[model samples]
Target: MTRSTVDKALQDDPFGNQAEVKYKKLGCGFAGLQGIYYNGTICFHRRKVIYGMPPNCTTLVKPRRTKGSRSPSWEELQVKLGNLKELVESARSIISGDMLAVPIVDLSSRIEVAKEVSACSYEARTSWGREIGWVYGSMSEDILTGQRIHAAGWKSAALNTNPPAFLGSAPTGGPTSLTQYKRWATGLFEILMSRNNPILLSICKRLQFRQCLAYLVLDVWPLRAPFELCYSLLGPYRLLANHSFLPKLAPGGTTKGCSGSSHPPPGSSHSSPCYLKTVGLSETVFEVTRKDKSSCDGNGSTDEADKGRFTFDSSPVFIPPAALAILKIVAIAVGAWRVVAGAVEDKRGGPGVGEFVCCSWLVLCFWPFVTGLVGRGSYGIPWSVKLKAGLLVAAFVNFCR
Candidate 1:
């Protein structure tokens, strides 16, 4: 591993005081661990770069044929490997990134900090917690350190350079990739949901506002699927129903009572009921077919479309776009009435450019939903269940709010 340039921020060069120190090495395979000392003082040295991570970091011993012991299974070893990559990258970041006071892992990036950055490190706990809580997740402890370090006036730096200071592999293939994503989303969400989340942490520990916002963005990931899927389902429903939930104009392309007819029929023997139609509309649509021509106007039956809706074996994601399209069609249907009104009289504010723009955004948000409709294996993932739960929770939260 290449030695990184040390930062000049450190005041103590105890290691540099060589005349007062001596070096000793126990017969061990771990490199750069040779014990160091001042005038026969006891202790050691270390490296600044990461080449790779050991598979079983929980134990320093490499998987070997040990007496009276069987080795880990293939699956167990894979899990270890998965964990190793995370550790390797995180260590690399600590060695490279500005977060020395508040290091973050992941994003496949590298950073650097001056070793002497400790000059501003007022907290005495930074050097004390090597193995105190290795098993339990006291990660908030680290977060707290970052908070104090920054609050105390220390600075950190990020470095982007070639020949990365450390190297690691992420999981590949659909199953692993998705599993990893879920794991990350879950962790962030859980943190956000807890008092340990950046918001509360910031309050308790003087965390910077900017850092808190960044933390919120990251921690909010797992909550997205449900809302997105809800929008996705709207598409097909709208297409099938031939209706839209959007608020309608009063009539004749107007918000007020600019009417022509009330929703009613002609005179009967007993009495006459009547209604008005204010908006006039007409539209043309083009659809593609594979072999033959579709010789019918949309005014007829929608048996084929209905059949596709009921029988299509697609993920739920496709629902939103279909719904959005249905909404647009309904809006156009109502607005088109203005054309009829225009023929007889002049109208102005009825479903103007604003309506089109609004509909356009609905269309835009619908695209991802359309893609989700056919999403492969999406139904089988646990994320689906979690998504539904998130939606319910959101609804309840909104109701309470």
Candidate 2:
């Protein structure tokens, strides 16, 4: 049967219903063959599909015939495995986008493919494992297990929440130290760095560094307050692409400063003294010109028509120090809110919210304390210190009110 016919047949059949369908390998040696199978069957003609292998191949063994050249060295295999791991990660990234709204089937498929590729690399390392005992052996397990666990947890949480509403709600711009983003990005960076994959490393860096910074200024700042201030500061300028202000950055518009400009104008006055000075001068001149032009036209400069073209390059549009202070206050409020939410939810006796948010707050609050204790303990400083600090903060807050 033609492709269209087969697709129609599959679509018409109820899931799990049996259908007598003909199968073909198209270009490969296998040709048209008739078969009756369940519609939802993963197996074809009573055999599981093997990826990247020809159909009806009986032997599960890899080709043993060695070419004139010797097999790759242990180091070479390790390098190859590392590259494969990076490729799998990149593929996963492409499939998941931001990991916030990925479909279950897509995520599962990508994870399965990643696991398969990872397994192949591990199998290839068996020979090398004999020479170098357990060095590269644990690498595959660490990657596969850690990634799968994280992805599963993330997916489950996302499913429980309403995505559109969650995303649409105004961000409570609160103070975040950029530490969590840095940590996650650093982990990915280390993996890619170890693999010596420059391309993946570059992508990771952009997402971690630039995107993280953007998220901090946008989502992290507005946690306790309505996003009006944050929106006023960033919405007019496309400082964050993922924000609602994206559509406003049309050609010839003033808001084009964010998306249209190659680099976002720095949010620090100290970084551009000349630009700030120029802005002062330009504002003065524009005001004078408007007054003169209004007199000449005998019609007051229309507010709508007189929307000035503020040159981003010559403007020192820093995040106000007040905004920063507001963010810190908001962060504290967010911590308090979390404590209250946790209590309320606990009282309700629903599924317990994990300590991730509380732990993150603790890290933000007592970063200095945790940093100082990093090298003093038998259990290793970072983990033990952070845990202790988190519990202490949570308890102290819980007792205060």
Candidate 3:
């Protein structure tokens, strides 16, 4: 494998840190009562199933070495699995259900065979990525592929272990973390827009109805960023306008009336466009999350201190948070100034406490960005980002007026 390939593989936290606890609940949860979708990395599959065999198909498995049966010749195997001899032999064993068969132990040959089989011609005119192997409509291929398997009337199980069976490194830096989330959000958004979405799959296939809803929960998460952004801005708006958009409480009953970017999912590197664009079916580039081996070791390490610290980069993802933080800070300062100036003008006139509280709450929510504004070196938000955020804050202030 190339160094870049190894690095990419190392960075993939397929199951994530809390996957054990999370998947355990998923297994027992009502949505998973029938079956559950899981990451492709830590799962096994039936050979026939991967070879486009539907669950309803019935087939008898023959012994690997049955009486009067001659071993298939290379010519026949090649016809079935293309010209790749190694892949053909591998497929033969899998097809015979011979789990005890010894595996190819030669690392160099294994790599060579892997490359050959992965070549485009290996699956020419075949239903490999589309219908047989890992379905490839979305960036999040694992979930989509599993959804198709379940829709084909297959069920999945989640098995947990005492010490856990698998472990992988997660992104430790804020930029890498946000980039990973952006890629995921983009992929889910793509699934949501596709015909193979859980809702459609459930209606047209064997996927359970409740499972569809569960999938919807994740697929719709990225779309909520706008609503959340609007909600957060409300606090600052209220502070600036001295007006509460929320419904007022009355002693008798209550007054009814309450309602709710360069618009990227939070943490999109600055200058990057929105991930939910529907212009065309262009493939979205995947950003590998940065991982560290030292973080995985359970030893009482000193690096734990830095693990929790927020790290900054030139990515636009920090722009929203920084801008929001700046707006909140400005709102609080203005609110305080108004209160003080009003108090001086009259004995007891000032902006209401509720407005200040709301603005303060928003500040708390984005406290990290506020601190980053003044943080030193790489620990701080880049000046270019800060300048952009300041412009965004200024624009928001003008719009409020």
Candidate 4:
């Protein structure tokens, strides 16, 4: 479809704020389905599939049928199966090729939802003061009940509550005060964060890393409190904004509570900031700078040299204690596995067999190299080195023979 058509379709959908759509013609004649998330919204869309039947002139039966024919011909069944297979293949292609788009509107919706929830909670706290404790206590019960009903597809249950407060607190033996209500809210946040694993996994399955990363960077991280807690958990690379995180921020300035040094200082006249700092999984703080703009000399005067400077600092970004622990365990396990594998290979024979095994291993181990060379330009390695290694191995094997 043309871009205009796709854009129109997205605009019509409630969730299509920042949607991206991709089109592909399936090699097999199957109908297709595309899953899309518009504008950072939680709602998902599956595109409808359309299929064409064989021409009407095609005959289903032979001209001369036996008087007592008990069974249908296998050819008809085969044709039906073929059509079904084609549809399945089309769906698979659309999903596997990552052809779905996320519209901007949906993202805006999610932001609105989060903000509304925060606003509601703030207003409740401000008005009732100590009575907010009981309010939350009652709301928690209603929320849990609503969740149960919602899970069962009773849509009305979701609307039963005036403001739709979830089960978040319980009445205390003594009079519940604002302090107690705040504590309950804090506890509820923790529960949500802990339960967010399933949501994260769903995002990973959909390969929506950008959205998943954004949700974690914003909703998940901010709940930890003390503002610094979020950065400390993210580690050094925290300066570099995540793929998902950047889109959620207000267009120009640095994101609130984010650790990175803002590029071009806050009030510069340039259109956008040059860089953002973020911590990586490695705890290293890296400055992610935008590519320099190309300079053009209109009147043949020499263009000024681009002098943007970037520095990669050695300070470790903050990481959540849990994430750090997991990384350490994974690193230790991988190291141990490599040591064991190497020892086993060494004991099996000498370096000669090992070398041959390694060559075969390379083919399987680095399939990306072959695929990259085929799909892209080159593997980014010297051909001479590869050739020399091959020849050296061939010569050694010949000597052994």
Candidate 5:
């Protein structure tokens, strides 16, 4: 069989978020370059590998031989496996690698054994989610589990097919998209901070150096939000107040009093408090992503009429972008008024083309929120969210004054 047919099916994820392409690129790089699996849903592993055996292991594992402890006898194995004689016999045969060698006479009995082991309590007090099977203790258990397997010196591969092996729904709108982003960010950040962190694993375990760097790229994504939020505010703050934080650029060289030493780095204090607060409060919580799976019936009426349009909710995730949009609008308006009133006497020192350009770029980044302000029905930014953003903008203006 071909690699595509033999390996786990490839996931054909629908594009929902604007940054979906970036995720795809990262996934491809991780799998192709590092021989590491990126998506949990698209990965396949040998049963022995899932049971914590390294790839090179050929013999069965032996239990620890302490003073009073020893390997379980056949009778004890029967009791621990289950009361079902068929299951006990099947387990013994499989452990000895002779299950397939014997012809299957009763298929129904095998099915019954499968059902029994599939029960919720089948893995209770066992090493299923702890040391043997899928690793637990994280929101993104799949990622952490895969990381551990790779750290154990096993390599993973990817399989691509002409037709995708699997198709998946993705979050379609702003609220769902942000919720998904939040969960992924929190989970990856947790992995970054945990003992299984790539740096520690590379040093202490067998995780490859390049693979560790690849994981770091994705794990550090959540940490960028605070920096981005701070960057967006600098443009507005410069325009509103007499004190400018960014260096004034000139044609020939740096301006007078524009030495890097004079200005305490822009947004240093502004982003630090928020960054610290976010780090302190970050928790690993799994949230279901809402997706749009609209289908057109014979009449052409669909459940989601505005499927491609950006939609809004009362989620706090929208608040920061909304407030930033409002701030940019206010700053631009005030800057234009300053130009009209001839209030900006100094072209060299005052808020000039650079600050306005930066603010305009930030406004473009928040275009979805800007457009949502005027959108109607479900596409509109909720009035409650607008009120909160307005209050934030007002507070920012007062602080600037």
Candidate 6:
């Protein structure tokens, strides 16, 4: 997605705001790589981490711990604000070059008081108040603001930089991740369903063809719900139920099945079945990582970044994963034992290798959930969390079945 923002927006509208404004103010919501992606830099890292990466436009939120407030010294603030001014100048030069005069407002600072001669600019030139002036209400507010700016003939770009200007924590663990996904999906759905949706923008000729097409993909992101539900549910069921709705072969019977096991080696085709995953590129992709550091690393910096860096959570929600994990373990163990028993005795028949292998993968994948069930749940889940887990498990079982 396009990293977003219009331009420096404040009473200082650095570049002369005509009675009508021209050009864009880039107000990315996060504090990120300062002067990192200015001018030629953004296009340079186009291939690897930059291109496929999501737009780093959101700047309103910082990655600070929300537990307390912090006030810094005036000397510290002065030094930082000086650096910010240089970056703002660099950001302005990126678009208009040296020919255009633009004022880069420091949203976090005002130059009202007297300061060192070298760092402070003229008192009259300073812009006070917020730098990111657009409506920053909730999820869709940023996108909507960017869309309005774009419609008004303003263009935006993401600056490429290292030591990002700002950073934030991502939702971790099963419970938190699921909660975040649901909220995001809901927000995305609401945006698509609204009159201000990209489709309407294109219909009204507010967006060009390419932009409209790009936004349409973002607009339809919520539709993945059903398909994701299907995969999450039916993927395991395929192994358990021992069937799939898809045909084994093409019209001429010449085509191999998706699993490559539709027709087995000559004589074995009559009775033996082939393994589905045995021929595919796959592995146990889901593993829950947990952090259990009891104390600080003794680093002088008590920054939240360090804390977040050292800690990552395991599965937090109960029910769905626990049920699935237990089911998978039981099924796979039983199936494997049966296969082993059959191998030891000529008279015995057992579960097919394909079924056993498929179920075994589910067992490995859901093992973390089993941990959540056994250990985490024992501590006593909150009544509120239990309610949510019940609803979540019902949803999971519905999809899988």
The lDDT for every candidate, in the order shown, is 0.32, 0.27, 0.63, 0.26, 0.64, 0.36
Consecutive 10-residue window with the lowest summed lDDT within model 3: 1-10
Ranking the candidates on lDDT from highest down gives: 5, 3, 6, 1, 2, 4
- Where does candidate 2 stray beyond 4 Å? 1-180, 196-401
- Model 5's number of clashes is 0
lDDT of 4 at 50: 14
- Top candidate when judged by lDDT against the true structure: 5
Q: What is the C-alpha RMSD of each candidate to the true structure, in Å?
A: 24.9, 27.7, 7.2, 27.6, 7.1, 18.7
Q: Candidate 6, 206: how far from true, in Å? A: 2.8
| Cα misplacement distance, residue 245 of candidate 4 (Å) | 40
Report the number of the highest-TM-score candidate: 5
Q: Write down the lDDT that model 6 would get.
A: 0.36
Candidate 4: give its CA RMSD in angstroms: 27.6
TM-score to native of every candidate shown:
0.31, 0.18, 0.74, 0.17, 0.75, 0.43
- Mind sharing the TM-score for model 4? 0.17
lDDT of 2 by residue, 215-327 (tens): 22322221212242333233211111111322232357533222111111122322232233334542111111011111234464444332221111111121232233223
Query: Scored by Cα lDDT, where does model 3 land?
Result: 0.63
**Model 4 alpha-carbon miss at residue 110, Å:** 23
lDDT of 6 by residue, 260-314 (tens): 1110011111101111112343221222223122244568533334221111133
Tens digit of per-residue lDDT, candidate 5, span 312-350: 888766776678779998999998888798888675467
In the range 1-401, model 3's lDDT, one tens digit per residue, is 00000112322222233234335564456334456565536666776666545564532222335465544544555554577666666666655455445475767758877887888878875556776778887767887787787777777665645454654456655676677667777777778888888889898988888877877766776677766777778878876755555444446755432222222243334212335355554446766777644444466654544444567887778888889889988988877777676632222333455556667766765666777899987779999999999999999999888
lDDT of 2 at 346: 31
| Per-residue lDDT over 1-401 for candidate 4, one digit per residue giving the tens place of the 0 to 100 score | 11112222112222212122211222011111111111111221222111111122122223136575422244432332232333333333332333342222455546655565345343432322121111122212222222222222221200113332232222211112212223323323332344333244334333234333323332232233434323322321111111122222344744333231111111111101111101112221222223223356887655533221111111111012212222223323433454456632324322222222222332332232233223322222234433443454344334333
